[model samples]
Target: MFKGKNRFQSILLFILDLSILISSFYLASFISFGDFNPNYYYYSLLLGWGIIWVGVVLKYNLYEVPRILYVDKVLSKNFSAITVFIVLSAAAIYFFTSYKFSRIFFITVVSLFSFLLLIFRILFLYLVKSQRLKKDFRKRGVIIVGMNQNIQRLISRVYSRPQYAFFIEGIFTDTKLKGRLKNNHKGGLDDVKDYLLTNNPKEVVISLPHSYGDYIDELIHIADNNLVRVRVVPEFSEYLSQRFSIKYVENVPVMKFRKEPMQSLSNRILKRSFDIVFSLMAVVFIFSWLFPIIALIIKLTSKGPVFFSQERTGQDNVSFMCLKFRSMVVNTDSDNLQATKNDSRVTPFGSFMRKTSIDELPQIINVLFNQMSLVGPRPHMLKHTEEYRVLVNKFMVRHFAKPGVTGWAQILGFRGETKTVKDMEKRANADIWYIENWSFMLDLKIIFRTVFGMLFKRDKNAY
Candidate 1:
């Protein structure tokens, strides 16, 4: 019943989107130009827009809905596609045209089309979910043929997202698993053939270690003979500590343990562009006036320079002079000792600056110099780096990306003093995770959280 369902849905969605775009353009023309009939130039513009829309739809893979679909995933994919389409349209208007298009009409059409597309997707998802709830939705029958942590995770994922429309028929495995996964296991691997002969499922998912190559191949053969689709889940959890992707180096397969978005030249350019623009804004708007005031206060309240510079680790395990507003008195122990709660090193105004995160504002200069990113793993002093490298596992991995003014660790309350090795470990883990899963959206999220926390939440660790 579910065969070719995705392709069918894709066709319907494409038709609906095209309809929305056409209706939007006409409606916009009527509203903006007081006529449904547009000029020849407008028709040309519409043709260009239609072509761009189709290209964008294909590029973002808007046609293929995953088996385990979620509302957020649906929305994110649509939003990305729409954003790219709008950007391309604007570029087209600027570079490719001498003819003047009605700005109001163009805006209205894009806005209306985007809104309608969003509404259509939401409605479609709601309908799919409703059908599933009523048991009117036909799910592809799937049989899992492994018993391990990865298979268990897959089972949990299937059960968790009922809207996915995948029904597990049975589980066939040789290994005996404990806990919640045990109930789902049917007969052993030997009985898989007999089971397939009797109760043929739509797909068989095989997740086994490399040691089971012969057995896994046999199982695949059996599934093929039974006219069932087969999927092999590689067991690399034991070897890989982070998210990995399989790539082909010529004819050889290579498993990359970490995927860094910043590795892409386009991503790096985007990040640097944003950093330059953001730092300029901060320097002009906030730091221009605030810097002098803070500097004067620190000079009067403390006995050292207004700006404190320390050698801290940056990307590629290199060291750079990290700048911050001096929040402490001149002392021999300043480099070696961490500031404790109500420590004597902190000045009267410095304590306030520390609490409000005003002291870190000078790092905006570092951002302008490309010594650090606006969001990443926070840089640590040389002493801390030396100590933590031996004490904490993967501590140095944080240096893979540029140090940040604020980071994932700081927002998650891993900031301030780390008195124990475990605390540093947690911070290191968060930094490593950020490096592995870095994205433009995630950087923005971390920045938002940092500002929000400074404004609303009190960080006891900030001292």
Candidate 2:
């Protein structure tokens, strides 16, 4: 029933659990007598533990969280449920098992498992949150047709959660109910159609009493004409928060969507603050060391200056000089040359630095100076930008944010030379995807991926 393909994620989780179980057994044996057998008892314990953990997750509805929910909330619930399960499991084992468990081993295992579970949840949530934060991840906005207390509460909740990423443009209600709404009353119901036409809200939420159900046909007709989404906040007493599936007569099935939780202003402010602080610290601590080393290597190996600066586009299509350690020969015609697999312009040391992404270290200063971000779309050269803007669809849209030191495209194996129009097209696609779906955790993931790639030496595309 999962919306996304997460088989790899499931396998990773299973491996983590298995590791915890096996380590617990080994540690317990080591502490007691340094001897343990892989017998029926061990097998039974592993099976029982796995089943119990999975059952606990199911019972707590951990897997049923809305797609747009923030990473923090999902992880908090998962952690609380898992901790309770571990405690109960330990109690049961102590009372029923013949072999006495070592307290230290039990504690260690519990702590380790808890940590792994939390890490996995954070990583998974970050990935999902990243996707949801994208512009395309937005759900159709719904206007509550009434201003009752319930509808007002829903509006308040939706407005409070940024991670919910649902924009509530305004509310449309009758004159009588309009006075009751604390805020978000755009205009009367009569003005809704015009507003919908002008502002283009994605959906309309009918929050009126049961008596107004008769207008469902009228609402549906309006929605159809405008090609908008429609939803009903039912007044039924047995309402449950559950997802539904939609199928056409002769088409692939699709999952019915749900309204997201509201994000608070404080949360947005806090996230932005975190981004600024984290990006600055990375510039000062990590990139500072690597920048000069790469610069020196480039200067000595090639006749060029230590740093290369080129005019590139930034947020809102603003131009800025993006700096990097020069990786090519001096005075070469940049307009005519794009790096190839064995470019003669690349010095021996420059090629190694490029492969490891050390040449891009100077961009950290850009991030610190607020000229770029630690993560976003990789900046393109002015000539390349001008060229691609003509050839690629929505290429200029990638200038929605400051260029990143490293980016989603770079981490997803799209870095280095763009030899063909198709190659540049793929990178542009990834760049736009990153802009539409930017998130704090996704930035961290890209940073982590970049570091891992560097260590493993996997940038074959770099000249």
Candidate 3:
């Protein structure tokens, strides 16, 4: 039944997902309490749950993975998103305090919901494949204009996925050669226009070598007048790059180059929203509870204020005061000091705080205020920034985005004291690369790395 309109198929999938969530919630309540008592709190919980699930689906591209749907891929994506939502749900419950919903019910609901969604997707894929095999569906005919290694690979992949409903109309080579595959090579480059006009393909894949750069414009002009979708398979092996994105500047198309992936604008906004909301919650719930104890400890241990503020360069070269729990000797000059192993300036409690990263927690306020991100390049002191800007290439470019409390550099064992110019240079290089390839997945990876790095004492420079 899923045929023809792509928009209709997408809408159907969304409705299926919504149905799965609602049914799972109902089942979970029954499993937990043996009765259904829908209350205002239940309504609010369902609303929040739906928002998170939909947000995760959009963020992860779960709904846009081409035609063929693999059960494993669907389940893996669903589990990852559900895990994040579960964490967020727990945090919400802890902070709100007034919601007396059963924890068992929430966990059951999420687990059942994810399982049902996964099963539904698997069944849908199976049915679609079955229908395609038994029925004479109209397959989209595709033609490759150039015969190269990339084109050959594309042909092989498309041929393997029969359920994708794409028919290859043979590859056109530029030069004649011996031992050519039977019925594969149609003709030389000159016959491309004539062949297109005759066949009327739905799409054209242009696979050309990097050496054929000069001929790209001519090829584009040939396909420009046609209604068929045109795609280029550029020789990217020479670049050895990871991230690829297209952007327009003043009506001119430009490709963004980077070692890391670029985060989408929507995901960036979502992450920033998450940072603000969570930071505010931390300040209100956790920090408010812990401040008096921290202050008492600091006051008894040394003769300084409870908090220490430092001038650091944030996103776009904007300066901000980064706050931290006081973790050093009272009279020490902060400007010249870099915490080192066995540093006499650090008090007993201060040393513990530094090792545990508790001293850095107050910067949650900075995150909430938009002066910093939850993850990015670590902000540098103004003096250090000046010193490193000269030593490291593209060092100042890291300031293109907001700095973070913890960052790629910190998690990668480049945190803390940079005793040598080379050390600082390496750190700055990592920071710049991180900025160029920012993504929500990359942020999650960094957070994972930081947790493991802390546990294993893997960061030698953290002192």
Best by TM-score: 1
- Assess the local accuracy of residue 328 in candidate 2 as a C-alpha lDDT between 0 and 100: 79
Clashing residue pairs in candidate 1 are: none
| Predicted candidate 3 versus true structure: per-residue lDDT over 149-179, tens digit per residue | 6566566666435777777776677665445
lDDT tens digits by residue: candidate 2, 98-159: 88555665676567667766776777667766765677765546566656555666666874
lDDT of 3 at 373: 81
Better of 2 and 3 by TM-score: 3
TM-score of 2: 0.48
State every prediction's TM-score relative to the real structure: 0.83, 0.48, 0.60
Instruction: Looking at model 3, report the run of 10 residues with the lowest lDDT sum.
Output: 258-267
C-alpha lDDT of candidate 2 relative to the true structure: 0.69
Clashes of each: 0, 10, 0
How far does residue 338 in candidate 3 sit from its true spot (Å)?
Answer: 2.1
Ranking by lDDT: 1, 3, 2
The local lDDT score (0 to 100) that residue 204 gets in candidate 3 is: 82
lDDT of 2 at 318: 80
Best by lDDT: 1
Better of 1 and 3 by lDDT: 1
- Which lDDT value does model 1 have at 179? 74
- lDDT of model 3 at position 239: 50
